[model samples]
Target: MTVIGIAADFDPPHRGHAYLLDRARDLGDEVVVFLNADYTAHHTPPLLPYRLRREIVLELGADEVIPVRGYHQRFPLAYTVPVRVRLMAEEGVDVILDAGPSRNLDRLREHVERVLEVSDLFSIPPNVPARNVVRWLAAVEYVNRELGTDVELLLIPELEGYSGRKIRAALRRSGYSPDSLRKVRRHLPRETFKKLERYLKARTPPIARRKELLDVLNRASSYELCSIAHLNTIAVREILRGRPFRSERQVWGALRRADYGSVLTRLALANTECRVTSDEIARIALSWCVERLVPENQSPDSMYRRDWFVAALSSHGVKARDADRLYKRADSYEEARRLARRRYGVDPGVPRFETLIGEARVSDGEYRPAISANGRLGVVEDGFQELRATAFGATLLRYVLDDPFVDAVIRVEDEEARLIVFPGDSP
Candidate 1:
């Protein structure tokens, strides 16, 4: 039995999606779709929830629908694409069906080969259109070579006149009203329109996790923010510069002024919402490398020097080839830094202690109260006391106040009251 596989967001499964599924059915006996999770690859929540999107796709004619998890949402395509291609290979998919700008298969293959040869998908030239197409093609080739799989690429011309962005914008503008559905009726399949209308009337669409995102943006320390995936020192400073953002738009404006592109801005917001730390991404990458590359009996320690792990290390501004070289030569992280500095005459943008605080802390207690950054009731002092807290201390205090099980510890030292907070279960 031949199985055709496709990976997509299918945010609202329109006529374009249905057409692709029809083509898949024509070519193969079974069609499997790997749908993006609650968050899309672009780092935003779907207009509809994952459950609704999955149901829509299944209704549209998918034999099996698998959900890609949060790990894909945390990093750039350079890191996640290989993992996705590996998934398709492991599923026994014979043909990977996708739509690209060009219909020339030989040209696409050549482009993919060139990218893999350089080992740097991040440095694709700006003049090249459809970089994602190149990235996917490269991923399929890389995974096929590594896993010894025979997954063939099937490229179809991109269907025109159905823009998911325009449909979503209309829905939002009309508040998901029935009239809005009617306006975009031509773009959606009959089944998709009916399902979406019924779903929208019965329940409101799920919104982005803006409150959680703002909570992290307004409260998280610079050091804590730096630990999030896709966030560098400059990005963290941009977020900090726009203090106490009232909404996501304000944060977007700040990032835009700092020359952050749409993709990076969305990634920042998504990372903040999920609180995805760099450490977490590294662990996920290491596990993926071990699973796909390492021998079953071999130690996992050797997995760190592999390609995927090198890609993960490249997140901190190191080039992929350079990271691979440094990984083999340097015994420790500090040694790697030293080598990079010597070779490049500059640090590879690693997060350092000095970057944590761009400004000095002031000791004036009256100016900086003991309250949390969100202005919630953090501390109550019965007697006279002066309170001064560091950014890290305030962040911890905010977390402590938010946790229901933790109790705040208050101490009185000679006429000054100090707040000592720790996270623990209630006695």
Candidate 2:
């Protein structure tokens, strides 16, 4: 049995996605899709939920749909590509099908190899059309070398005149009404258009939590705001100075003043909405760090420390090559920070909280008025002290806030506290 693989967000299944699925079906007996989770690669919520997107893909002829989570929220494309390639390799995928700008596979592979030779974190050459095509090819070659996998890449010409941005803009402009759906009908498949119409009528679009995001940004202290991902020191200062934001636009203006581009600004807002801290991002990155990056004979403790250092540096915008250099020269995280500053003039973006000392479990609590407008404030007992806490994220705020019992790791700074709750188990 031949297994073909594809990785896509498929935010809302469109004509391009349908084309890819059809191509993969023709080339292989099984088509396996690795779909992005609720969040897209740009660290924003998709227009549709993950379940809906998966259902549409299956309806379009995917044999299996696997959720690719954790990495996309924090890491760059360079870090994520290798992880996806490894997932395909592990899933027994024989060939990966993708749409690229050019049909010249050898040329694309050559471009990827050159970029990989320089640094894995470096972006593909701008002159190269369809950089993601080169990225996937590079990742496959790297994974094959490191893990001895024999997966192959198959590139097909990308279908033009289908744009997710254009479709999304039309939907938003028309308030996601049936009329807007009809306006962008040609960009979508027949099934996609029908399903989307039903979805728009039955359920609200998967838009960002603007009210909750604004409340957090307006109320959070500079120190607390700085802890969120994509918010640098300058951004924090700008946000703090422009407190009491009445609308999302005001907050965006502050970020613009802070020199944040469109994507980074959106990411900062999304992170604030989820209350995603730098420490949490570092922890997530550590989980994704491939074992093959390190030697086999290294002790578990040493390997963990090295991975932690790399993850931390990556979160701080340090390139992979520089992070590796710092890992070899420094004996501890503090030493690594010093070395990075001395050599590369890198400033530690977020203040590192103390390591997880112990665990605490929270019991039932009633709703109380707090920082977030959604009334999610509560009290959590950590060791001998009780700390005031506010929970964010859709599922967390909905269920855990009022649940009878939950286990979490509490990290505190001064009187402010943030909870790190891992699903299914206590950290």
Candidate 3:
């Protein structure tokens, strides 16, 4: 079978990305796009997560969208290209596609049996020639070694876009304001722009303010602080050590100047070492739930102004179990379900999951269950279905659903709706 694969970071995918999909669709029966993971993106890691990026590309009509975990690894790097290529081969990618200027031809031939260069980057505004050349050459070398003679490249110049760099810069400079978003809208596809707009409105700043970080750390755990502080675990951990649990004064001294996320965390925790209350913790947990609902939009605080989280939890009608157990983070979704089961005896599931009774069960180490939403028990398969699971309400459903297990039975108590999940579970 002939399969086509294209690789890109597509941070907020532009029209150029859609052009590749359209062309690839014409070239092969299946077109798969390999997206760069968050850590592997060309610019700062504040770029969208791999899942979100894959979702955007899939919307572009690619048959499949797989994230390239460590995008740039090759000879003289951390890992060998052959190993990576073998993995792609396992996915049945017969040809890998790329795009660039006409001069990229010579180097393109070295990788893959067939190569497709979509254009000479004509639609792109001119930029630093030397840097583009270096990046282009390095990509060519890496792709050549990665795909070798087994893949093919075909050149078709039809892609157009506002360079990714420009969009990111505009977003940063504008502080994601209305006019800036409007300007950005000119460069992205309609659906892509919609997602981007939501992201801009809801996402945390790529860098945290020193004052804001200090305020949040005071009431948040090292883990919670990481999310609020927007720092990695290591940095957060480093800022959280001491004798008799170091004083805020000492921590502040150590954090005089550091990554915004860490600095923010230390500052937030400065005086909050032992002052965090249950209400504050509950607010944090609800915030986490909001994050799960809209992973791209990190503004869980938005739900609070309207009492949305509390109202939703109250609707679940949980009884006979302490809801606080739900707020504890789980290492994984499956673990979250397990913790729920331990707390509630019978598994909490949508009335229309695998059986009419809606008893939850683990599948592939994941909780695959229907969720009761909008007064209807609906399961989000490839798409959402409003109908019952089966005529008898007991029909076993196919396909795993990824909505939160807590969706079906939330308990609103103690002035907060504590979401149930296992410890270590990220939204």
Candidate 4:
């Protein structure tokens, strides 16, 4: 099988790159592209990272992408023609394709069946959309003049101006939204847009995670970790600044000093090797809250920023925790219970503290004087003491109600009464 060789940076393959590959594929059995390695510097405009660029090239339909690692470093004195020729020979390639103008066609001819050169069709000045024709003609002439190789220079003009410069410039100027970029990308063919999106994602400056953090702050509650949310947001933003947000404590201190914007901006600018996943962040948020905000014995009443509570629990892959945090303090019990069930698999039948309060009494004496036939406080000693006792009673009621075998009996009849029934139905 004849192996066709293509030289490419393939930084998120664009339409022009795809055109060359497609044209070459028709003339060969297998096509192999020499990819720029992570360290190679390609003067291609709006370049993406090497790994991402290679992936895009693959997506664009390259049969194989051979990493051209150390090529530039090792062949610093040689032009692209010699280096590529050496690389192709190693791969046992027969035919060769160059997207750029071939500078050394005669030399290349010695190593391959044919050397084809393709140009960026879209980059031609719109006024003279076929400007590449001049370049193509010149390339052919160069071969005829320099090497006496009358080699054919194929001209594939990209009509839409899909150059990296154009794409980047357009993206910066609001000529396109990200969503619009994705939609219009379809017009460029699969491989082309894959390269484009890859380049954009790789080279685009990281946005601060602070905005997301602040958004988190809008909903955090006390029972969750307030400091952790602030820290996570800061840490993510710090990554953008080329600095890692090392610890929750550091984030907390920075937040205490109201240095939020500075750290956030830093993290927003720095890019991580891995983008933060929602599940990962959710887990982080949950841990932060569970450890910081919602400590074992703390009441939910003192909390602020309810969103943080919800986000933390949800972020931690604990959908149940998130639902509980969101609904636990709801004004309506049914609403709270319903949300708990739907989001977290919490059964509404679980006994509440309220159920216990109504069924238990602190003392028999306290329960006795209250029952007047007319529903009046029949010579009660002190209403304040009674109120305090009742509050205590309510808490105990809920604790016991949680027991599966305990059936609480709370009654207010004739005047007032309450009781607790156990497994045997005895009160």
lDDT by residue for model 1 (1-427), tens: 9999999988789989998998899999999999997788777888778887888898889999999987555766766777777788888889999877765667766777777665545545656777788888877776777788788778888788887888888898887776689889999988788888888877777553367788888987654665575665456667777889988889989788757899888877787788875455545554655555322211123332232234334544557667667755665546766776676554544321111111213332311123322232223334212234444333333333322222234343343434432222111
Of the candidates numbered 1 and 2, which has the greater lDDT value?
A: 2
Pairwise lDDT winner, candidates 2 and 4: 2
Q: Model 1's lDDT to the true fold?
A: 0.64
Off by over 4 Å in 4: 39-41, 44-46, 71-78, 99-160, 172-187, 191-427
Tens-place lDDT digits, model 3, residues 254-287:
3443343432443234223323322333344344
Q: Model 4 residue 28 lDDT?
A: 77
* Candidate 4 residue 357 C-alpha distance from true site, Å: 99
Candidate 1 residue runs with Cα over 4 Å from true position? 291-427
User: What local distance difference test score does each model get?
Assistant: 0.64, 0.65, 0.43, 0.40
The predicted structure with the larger TM-score, 1 or 2, is 1
lDDT of candidate 2 over 314-364, digit per residue (tens): 555677567877666555556777887777676443332223222223443
Q: Give the lDDT ranking, best first.
A: 2, 1, 3, 4
How would you order the candidates by TM-score, starting with the best? Answer: 1, 2, 3, 4
Model number with the top TM-score: 1
Number of colliding residue pairs in each model: 0, 0, 35, 42
Candidate 1 pairs with clashing backbones: none
RMSD from true fold, candidate 1: 9.9
